[model samples]
Target: MPPKVQQKSKEQKMAAAMAGGKGKKKKWSKGKSRDKVDNKVLFSKEQFDRFHAEVPKMKLITVSAVVEKLKLNGGLARRALRDLEAEGKIKPVLISRSQRIYTRNVAEGDDE
Candidate 1:
């Protein structure tokens, strides 16, 4: 005699797929919801200009300082600073595991 095998219904198959084949349900994290709200707020030109102007005065600019000065979230501040670095407006001084410091880019012959 052969053993009997049980077959899954359409809903059961869907449930399995939704649970990533693990039988355990996945839950959304609070950080994800907060990120959705942060995405809605765009970085403005005026804010960028202000950041640019402020960079030279400070010997080193870190993400926390930018966040405090501009009243922006950590992720947004980091992204904006990276964008400015990519644009050649600023150059990084020191990058460590915990923090990165940046300074304004100075040309070869320009006296600061």
Candidate 2:
């Protein structure tokens, strides 16, 4: 007599599939790419003029704020804020060894 051939049950087949039979191996993902930063280390003449004119007019001024607005380096922004304060264009609202904040000098009035 021939050996009896057993058939797999539906549950058994499903279990085998669930076990990841014939599944593809995990691949190495390159991951999401980040855009390159092109921050300016030095300012052009026009940018410097714009920075001097518009920055003092802003309601809030900080190193990071200036950096984002003009794409400037942090040290450059800090120096700029210092210069503007010296020029009497902006008045310091907060001062500390770590950070400083400034606002437009309203008493000076708006002058082109």
Candidate 3:
């Protein structure tokens, strides 16, 4: 925020206190925030197509990556990664409760 705005607010508070009413006491607050929306639980046809086509070629693959790229829910991205791994288009590098990582299957090309 600009220093001038803060100065103005401070001046106003001082003026208010001098006018006989105690100025609004500073209160604790959860800092800056934003309204969040739920992730999509289902995929559109375009997203599905893009997922299958581009994901396999990506240098790194993870649930969060898919969710961000496809605007999918965590569960959906997890399941998609599992399915792709099962299909052998991507190879799992690690699997854990916190995260899963995968890489492109260089053994195969776009024969389909």
Candidate 4:
């Protein structure tokens, strides 16, 4: 006598899949929906100049503020802030794990 094996039905297979058969599904966070910026993308001289001009008026600047002001995405705003900092146009006032606040760098004679 031979023994017969039973095959799983589609419903059973789907249930198994939902019940931890695979790794967790990717979660959609608020920040995750923002477009990612390309590292190779650099700002134009004109754009940098505009930011530089406007930065002094802002006592405190953040990535979100830049995004709103320049109409840039989250990632691009972050990169722009970093670039400004690197160029000595802006100085970081506060640095946190997820966010940074910057203020315009005062020129040597500007304050006098």
> Highest lDDT among the candidates is held by which one?
2
lDDT for each residue of candidate 2 in 4-110, tens digit (9 for 90 to 100): 99999999888887898566678999999999768788889988999987897899999989998999888888988898999899999999999899989988876
lDDT tens digits by residue: candidate 4, 1-112: 7798889999988898889858678897666565755432355787667766886557789988876676566777787788878977778999999889998776733463
Query: Which lDDT tens digits does candidate 1 get at residues 50-100?
Result: 876775556578888877677777888888788878887778998888888
lDDT of 4 at 6: 88
The 10-residue segment of model 1 with minimum total lDDT is 32-41
RMSD, candidate 2, Å: 8.5
What's the lDDT for candidate 2?
A: 0.89
Candidate 2 lDDT at 15 equals 89
Models ranked on lDDT = 2, 3, 4, 1
Q: What is the TM-score of each candidate against the true structure?
A: 0.52, 0.66, 0.71, 0.52
Ranking by TM-score: 3, 2, 1, 4
Q: Which is better, 1 or 3, measured by lDDT?
A: 3
lDDT value for candidate 1?
0.74
Cα displacement (Å) at residue 8, model 4:
38
Clashes in predicted model 2: 0
RMSD of each: 11.4, 8.5, 11.4, 8.7
Deviation (Å) of 104 in candidate 1:
1.5
lDDT of each: 0.74, 0.89, 0.86, 0.75
RMSD of 1: 11.4
